[model samples]
Target chain A: MPKMPEGTVMQRLAQLLFFSALMVFAGYFSDSPAYQLLESGQTELKLVVRHSGNIIGECRALDTGEIAALAPNMRRPMVCPREKAPMRVELDLNNKREFTETITPSGLHDDGVLALFRKFTLDSGDLILHLRITENPDAGGLPRDYEKQFQVDAHSTLIVEYTDSGFSSWQPQHSPRPRL
Target chain B: MKVEAFLDRFFPAGSNPLYQLGAVSFFLFWIIAVTGLYLFIFFETSITGAYQSVESITHEQFYIGGIMRSLHRYASALLALSVTIHLIKELGMKRFQGPRWFSWVSGVPLIWLLFASSLGGYWLVWDEKAQYIALTTAALFDYLPIVVEPMAFGFLDGTTVSDRFFSLLIFLHVGLPLALLLGMFIHIQRISNSSTFPARGLALSLLGAMVVLSVVKPALSLGPADLNRPVQTVQVDWFYMNVFPLISETGAGAAWVILLGITIALLLVPLIFRGVPKPIAIVDPDYCNGCSWCFADCPYDAIYMKPHEKLANHLQSVVVADKCVGCGICAGACPTATPFKSVNNAYSGINLADENNAAILVRTQEQIRQHPQADKHVLVVGCAHGPQIDQLASDVVTPLTLECVGQLPPSYLDYLCRKEGVDSVLLTGCAPGNCFHRLGVELQEARLAHEREPHLRFKDVHVKVTTLWAGAGGETTVARAVAQLQQDERIADAKDA
Candidate 1:
């Protein structure tokens, strides 16, 4: 059972004031006193891997009897593997391996592109970065490697994007302290 | 719970925030929707124009569009606070158990929806904070098994993201709330006469407070999001973006575990607090003439009318046992529960499996007959959920406690006053605005006022029926009301003399 209160005019006004004060206070700080999203003191290295490795097998012309053996729709003059070769990627800083991954192509037949995006925190200093990609190992495609050196600072971002043809790198400066 | 009771001293008349948390949240949603609509009028849903557009709204159009933007953000924060607190309060009260599990479970998805919508809203700004949110959210999703292509590829900063992606973000940010509104509608589906909006004054006060807060501290965006330049320290709205730091510093994998873990735990709340199930209402089809009163009165939507097996072409009330909380409001609505039934051991059309009105009537008859003789015989019928009333039983008054006062049929008053010669009946139950069974107090009040079915046949009874509702600590209040009732009856008798 609830005891009914007198609910005087003074009490109502006092409550309204109290509620308004509380609401305003909560509403203000609810999103106010905005905080930093991440602490400073480390550089962010984002390695974006986007590539379509070489096809698994070389295409070869069919012999006359082999061509006749194929079904009508499949009777193309040449035969090739439908799948792409797996790609292996590695990253090293100052000759020490920082990350390594073996990425498989997408799709049921594994005939699509290989992509792996990752971010690694690095200490702020001048250092060498080594990126290596090995594709079509079974089909004799040689490994490709690239290296760069830079004087990095806290909160700097070094994006290393790789493609089938080659690599592109960019180092964007960080805001002085923190941006609001 | 004690904190809520402390509010009675100030907000007792009409403005209890704790009582109106759900309704207050509805009010805040309305604020968000209206302000969001206003902001959308000037918003350009493109990545290039997104950040600049919001900046223009904040600085260029400071009065109209600017204030609307601030209100939108602030109201959302308030909504999150309101919703989280509401969940906590309901959990403390263990409202997730029993038939209420449906409501509790339905609300679980709404939390996720709220988070998703807020996340999308942040992305639309295309600021540094947006960059942080988009990347972290993408990283979290990338860990899930469903991602064939990495989800984070589209969010690799300025070079990869497309304008069309902004279109999608705006669509979800604007559209997901529609799903939330639908979920909210479903949440209160089982409850009858629900007030989604709060009292007018409270609504205005809350809106006024938000308006003031918006003017006090307008929301602003951080530097434009740069992918090449990774997000460092950026000011974040703590309410919506509390986990961004964790996602940024502790790894997305850890954040994934905690978020999913909390959601799973919330979903299992009812099971965690599951108590012995309450007895469900049972129907006696033979006595039921398909009146449909019980079907109409059931608060949980636990009763449905089906074709009577015994009576030709007549509808009979059937109870859905799983949904029934056994409040017995349906039994009170049953015409067969009328005290006028002459048949020995007669059953009501619908009744709690363990107790019936006939049994209550027999007990009440014995109590009234055994009471000490006096000029006036007053009986107090209360419920188990309300204040202790056994102390009120003495020479002048008799007390009868039922599972719920609503289980007492309206005509029971007529029976006590006419056949049993009781002077008056005072019906009591859970507090005025709060009923453990949701609709018990309201339904009982309606039946007494002759507004609903099973109306009291008080014409020839000459009995005074009064009602006073109090909660667990309200014994003093009930005693005062009882004393007032005695004084009123004596004065009436003196005037008649």
Candidate 2:
């Protein structure tokens, strides 16, 4: 047989080596984090809501350390004081709705609007709140209105009613409104 | 005229032994597959589990699983070796040129598949090498697009990427082998009468070798893979991984592209060059005996026994041209030497000068005889077998003394045909199962059909020119065979003749 062309064997050998290395690397060293998360059980969830063109009213339980709200302008911040007892925030979106339960804290904590939003697990939906304003009629008025509903689908939001006192027919601010 | 010559060239009358080797190698692949499937059921594809599974086969399941693994590995290595050798032999013999080019072209992808399959086999271990390989592959993919989940803080959730990484590896391990099997099938479609199985002895011997090797140097994993530790050095199978170092230099994608380009070029080589018209062996109507040696001996199912209408002397004869690789085993099988000469039989009846014919034939034969002192020069005089004569001459140092100025050989002539300094012999006899000596030719043909060489057949070496004829009564048959042999200018005229 003709002497194999010069370097032909070597070239073939090199190719085999390269591909083999690639396969090996792909199999063993693939360090994807998603898998690690699934393995480690250290899952963290973060939620951010911004309203561009509307007035919004929102309430949150600051004690639970759940949600955080960031206003377009950082100058005004509201912290919802921890309630004496565990409280729930019900959100109604489009038509469907869900509620989040939060516990009150013992020590003094940030009562800002941002802190209150973080306290509860608000299901994605619209917000229709019925609350008993304890201190002021319009004190740190309800959280700004967001066009988009929190619930996964439209017409869904939180509908809150203050149960401390007999149910009152308070005009709904329809804060955190569903946006297109 | 060019078209006719082209048609006649590729469709030459004879069989190629390389084609036979390819056939046998194909069967070997199937053997590998059946065995591989058995092993795959037991194999653990995971990094941590793979090595242990393989070890279990060797330690616990030695009788069945171990044997299967050994067979699979051996078959893989053998398949690669056989294909490479087949390619080299064809190239050296210049058989890859002409109509046989597509086979050569398709061969490149086949080589790639072999490598892919072998590499995937490596990963099944998930050893240190596998770990290193995994990291390297991930790095390669990192260069591609990385989609961002704005809700998430990081550019990539490392966890997601890692999950995909494992999925991809698993997919390749399972999928590539199937593809390789498909490629093997396509590689042999063009050639006829190719053997799918190696000789039983040869198969057994190959399996034996694999067993010995596996026992002596069992495939071992290089410890558990550590992502933090860099693999500085590792034992590499040069046959499969010679290009790894190049990857370090040129970068992976560039190396990959260059290698792919080279493979494509190698595969398409047959289309890049041309060769002499494929010579077809033709038979003289008068000399045939209706015997059937060529039909039995033809490696490529090129020859067939057909009833003779014109000649009363012969009952049935072999007819083949398009499927022939012109190996000439058929011509060598002819008893009456009815199919004489390598070129068109019509070329012999052109009535060239008598003295010229004598001088050329005698001179060519004499040169062959004299060349024994330098190196065994064997003059294989035949018509349809001419191309093979050229092939043998180019490969073996022996001078091929040809004689187109001739007739088919009788039984006595077969015994008389001999050359000095010849280490081996080859004759392109007429198509198998169709000779004149009432089985005499077939018997002689049997002697030439041994499978002595793994990459070559003795039948291929000893050939017959089963198509070209020298006309009636065998008067000018010898002269025509002699004339066909003289086409090679390398032969010097003998002073005595």
Candidate 3:
């Protein structure tokens, strides 16, 4: 309930003016061409891998006797790796190769513990995308090779994978954005 | 001079715009929230429609939708700036120490929450920059133990981004702000009389400025996101996106480490450094009537009213020891703390430690005796901070300094100017709008003006009040006022002769 002293009302007015000026300064200074550029839209495409097949080592049949010797009452899985395999991935957009990269498996040099991490961005639109991935590389080259094609739009992300049945692609559907 | 003092010169304490940064942030949040709701009405969450929907809102409804969109964006940026400045000011003033730890600790997470919410907002646009923010934020999240799947995978090659994912994004954009509001509430819970809204004039001016900015330069979205092309350069809002560049330079994992490290360090600060220690207010149940005056006046919510069995008053005063900042304003508000009142116990009501309590009275007495026989006997009451009235070379005035001008009961004004035979009372303290104790000068002013409780009873006595808004230069202003008062008194005496 305390009243402001003499001249305080004027002081408060001056403070408001100062702050309004600051807001004006900040807004104009920040809303430059660069900010305008950020505000506008652009075409972009992002690609990522979920379970990359780029193997780091050779995938070989597991020996049940060897697994049993290592651990009692143990059964060996069908797929085992002597070494980690290198996952080689290639991307072609509009029939033009835009990116190619190799990812190594995560665990052990690849006793079949394949862990591949790969991400890349490309142009967006109604474009054809040719993706190829090799699970394991032999002495000659990648023996497990998979390929697929996709048509995508701007601002879209495509997940490419090399699976047991060959290459596959999936584009997740977006939910309706909630309105107030 | 410290930045506080420099800024205080322009923004005095009684009611300054700078004093309302917290309130301004709250105001900006409301603005952002309301505008965001409007923008959301026409927004699309799908990767395909998100861009089109925002564009429609922009070009299709330029006058309303476009302006609202721009306001949402700009107000959000302003909110960030307001909060950062608020944090820095709190740090610079060392308000983060001591019992203020709750607010400081609570505030650290609010910043991250704000950033997270902002990122969600960007993603809703589904533009190139939104894409960039989405990818980087997912990459950053992937570094944490909680992330089982790299959220970045959702946007890869347009294959995994789903309606459910976009729904989560929308939820984040909406939900996190609510969380931030809750955090803000907790941040101010321990403080009494916290302003959740800025002054009406200040609020209106801020709204006007934002509207002008929105009309002048509307917010635009970056080009639609195309995963085939990497984001190169775009206009970035430095407030929310400053750390993005740092993340780009240092990699997501390193960025996470750096940010987490800083947050942890700041949270630990209140624990590591204790602020200056002071005596806590002691409550005397015998003398306390539980009138709640002290409870109402305590700037810090340190005192509480508790049920008392013996006294006729059902509730008595209790001081939460750690929460008390020992400003002694509570003592000043307590009726029993007045020295002039006859009390059964000297340690009655809420009192500071004896030494400090006795010192206040002794100091006032000694200072008043300095110029008793002067041509015009004058008592100058000022705050412990700002220009020191005691240091002034004036024969006509005696200066009494209090921890805060508000810490002196209204009765003191009557006792000094009337009973003590002083011709005039000159009240001075921090400049307009800048009381060190927040409401010290304000409370004192109201008491002297008889607008509040504990009114200054001697209405006929001459009492002059001035704010030392100029810091050190306030000394001259005080001296000149004293000389003028003396001269005015001499003239009146001569007329009587």
lDDT of 2 by residue, B360-379 (tens): 33444455554445432334
- Runs of candidate 2 with Cα error greater than 4 angstroms are A1-180, B1-31, B45-79, B135-175, B199-201, B226-232, B281-298, B302-444, B447-497
- Sort all candidates by TM-score, best to worst: 1, 3, 2
Docking class of 2: incorrect
Error of 2 at B469 (Å): 24
Instruction: Give one digit per residue, the lDDT tens place, for model 2 in A62-142.
Output: 433222344346323345434322223333334454334332222233121211221122333344332222222133334
Retained true contacts (fraction), each candidate: 0.48, 0.00, 0.20
- In candidate 1, what are the lDDT values of residues A30-92, reduced to their tens digit? 555665643577787888888876677689999989999988888988888888888888999
> Best-fitting candidate, measured by DockQ?
1
Every candidate's DockQ is 0.34, 0.02, 0.16
lDDT of 3 by residue, A89-129 (tens): 77777788878777554444433333334454554445676
Q: Estimate each model's TM-score.
A: 0.85, 0.46, 0.78
The worst-scoring run of ten residues by lDDT in candidate 1 chain B lies at B5-14
**Comparing chain B with the reference, what is the TM-score for each candidate?**
0.88, 0.57, 0.90
- Whole-model Cα lDDT per candidate? 0.80, 0.43, 0.68
Q: How is the predicted docking of candidate 1 categorized under the CAPRI scheme?
A: acceptable
lDDT of 3 by residue, B150-233 (tens): 666565645446667677778888899899989999988988888788878668878888887788878888777665444556
